[model samples]
Target: MAKDSSFDIVSKVDMPEVTNAIQQAQRELEQRFDFKNSKSSIDLESDKIILVSDDDFKLSNVVDILESKLVKRGVSLRALDYGKVQPASGNTVKQEVKLVQGIAQDKSKLVIKAIKDSKIKVTASIQGDEIRVSGKNKDDLQAVIALLRKEDFGIELQFINFR
Candidate 1:
């Protein structure tokens, strides 16, 4: 009997890259003319990033700079869930950017549904935060990968552990 071909779909972010992005953004913030003498700052916590600025406009600029750095470092913006700006101490506006590390439950359901609806000869099962797709035919597995690539799952999906 032939073993099944399989691959895992996951949404993962490289924390080191995120850290580098934050450092670059901070460096740029310090040098930007507009931010000079401003209290704009970006801080990375365990699973989230904190952005604080003197006002809403500055906060937005901070977010843009961080996003550009993240993109340049090959980090998907989708992995960062933005929170609403709120007032912080010292009259600064603050925003929390949550880092998404895995395929959410709703998103997992969507992945399974899309595969089932495609009527492809394969099976998709959710294992914790990742989805495992398997089939007897390698061609079918490739087809499923193509199908998933065309669909927007709202988050960045990576195909890994292929066999």
Candidate 2:
């Protein structure tokens, strides 16, 4: 009898990489002439990033710097869920951006449903924050991968632990 192959589908962020990117952006903000005295700052909370600036233009500049640093560190922009900018005191504005790491409960269900709808001979189970898809044939697995890649989940995903 032949054994079935499997892979884990996940959306995970490397914390160290994210920290490095934040630090790099901070350094740039400090050294850049325009932002040096602009009183702009970036803060990373548990699940979100807060950007505060003296004005809208400064806020945009700060966001651009952060995005560039994230890209340099191999973090996809799609993983960043940006929120609305709110006005603060003294002509300042604040923006909160959430980082999507693991798949949420609703998304997990969607993934399973999609896999089942594909009519492939496979088993998909939601394991904690990730989805595990297993099948007897590698071709079916490849097709699943292709289907997943075509879906817009608003977060970056990676297939790992293929066996």
Best by TM-score: 1
TM-score for each of the candidates: 0.98, 0.89
Q: Which stretches of candidate 1 lie over 4 Å from their true place?
A: none
For residue 24, give model 1's deviation from the true position in Å.
Answer: 0.3
Please report, as a residue range, the 10-residue window in candidate 2 with the lowest summed lDDT: 35-44
Q: Distance from true position, residue 71, model 1, in Å?
A: 0.6
Error in Å for residue 158 of model 2: 1.2
Please give the TM-score that candidate 2 achieves against the real structure: 0.89
Global CA lDDT of candidate 2, please?
0.91
User: Which lDDT tens digits does candidate 2 get at residues 101-135?
Assistant: 89988988988898999899999999999999999
lDDT of 1 by residue, 30-133 (tens): 99999999999999999999999999999989999999999999999999999999999988999999999999999999999999999999999999999999
Regions of model 2 farther than 4 Å from truth: 89-91
Clashing pairs in 2: none
